[model samples]
Target: MFSDSTITENETRRDLPAHLEQLLRTICFRIRVQGREALKNYSITAAQFDLLQRVYFNGPQTMTKLSQSLGIAKSTTSGLVTRLVRDGFLDRRRDETDRRVFTVAITPLGEQVIKSVIEMRVRYVEEVIKQIPEEKITLVHNALDILYEVMSPKQH
Candidate 1:
């Protein structure tokens, strides 16, 4: 039951206990921390890693797009982009068709980090998953896949 325990389970989807939601959020945060630790020698922050991921997967982005995607202010995005540019991890160039607009692209160095970060994170998760029973692992994998598909926003 939720919403002061008055809402009936039949009123909506299965009752989602608040703790389960918090647990999922906590797991996500912990995994990101593990990734940050894996990147200790790269001198990059978690924010930078996340931004690099978004750009790497989605391609070059305008400052406005970056800010909106990263859920940060344009000024803050500027600082992050400036730092990445200074460190040779990202490049900023003016759009040829629209001189007033600027776009940011990940550099080779950034690409390398993206691969390493992904591999490192995958390996970390693998190590943890190995602890689970083989049969249960399959169930967990399938369940998580379903959960992701159900919870993720619809693609454009």
Candidate 2:
């Protein structure tokens, strides 16, 4: 039969996963909310910012690819691309070899918006991290690195 202390320890170990999940969710929610606040300054919606960020990082992509990446309907992606293009944040070009195909690329203006949003988000994180003690910061950083390394996809 297990002692009282051992039972308590076993229960805590079982509960650790739930505590970790809540912490992760809370952190992500707060960061996303902060990002939305940053987007307001750029006069862009979160969805639009996501689309632009994807193009900015991944280079030009076809409408079908964008739709897939964004997990939105083709029609929805078309509307977004049209609005972004009209706003001069994205440039759409017809393929030379396949006239029916079109590619969407982020414009310089789009890049500027993305950079600004990222800077704002980073600043927010910096401010939050400043509250933590110097020594604990290293431990937190190391823990996050390990978490990311374990969760990241393995290269074939």
Candidate 3:
């Protein structure tokens, strides 16, 4: 099990917010620990999986869209996309309306891999949370909704 003892180390509770750091670490740790092996099955890393998921669910997208979705730089997303394209997980094409613009979509193989990964995730969640009551599931959703709202970026 992952230890969270360091979350209580800082007692200033003033200049620096310990809870925020702890929250970030805990979330990262959980994803790394829980999703590590699951990712290996698809020959992907966590970052790769995140990118692929964004594409699978919300693409055919421009590099800008992927950068924004992944919270990384456009250059970084471009590199990731390049590697994916090389691996045949995605295809890039110029937009007909604007030849200068490029977009990407999951290839058939990518779709199949993503589909399998999704099913694995669904089964994992069901098995892990099966003991929780339906009412608690609603509570979890409500809590996440609040968290999402709080963490949402401010629009310019």
Top model number, TM-score:
2
lDDT of 3 by residue, 36-55 (tens): 55566666656776788789
TM-score of each: 0.79, 0.87, 0.59
| lDDT, residue 48, candidate 3 | 70
Clash count (model 2, backbone only): 0
Tens-digit lDDT string for candidate 2 (84-153): 9998899999977888999999999998888877787788889889999998999999999999999999
Model 1: per-residue Cα lDDT over 93-147, one tens digit each: 9998899999999999999988887777788899989899988998989999999
Predicted structure 2, TM vs. truth: 0.87
Highest lDDT against the true fold, candidate? 2
lDDT: the better of candidates 1 and 2: 2
Better of 1 and 3 by lDDT: 1
Model 1 per-residue lDDT at 70 = 90
User: lDDT for every model?
Assistant: 0.86, 0.88, 0.76
Of candidate 3, the 10-residue stretch with the lowest lDDT total is 6-15
How close to the true structure is residue 36 of candidate 2, measured as C-alpha lDDT? 66
Candidate 3 has which clashing residue pairs, if any?
Answer: none
* Candidate structures ordered by lDDT, highest first: 2, 1, 3
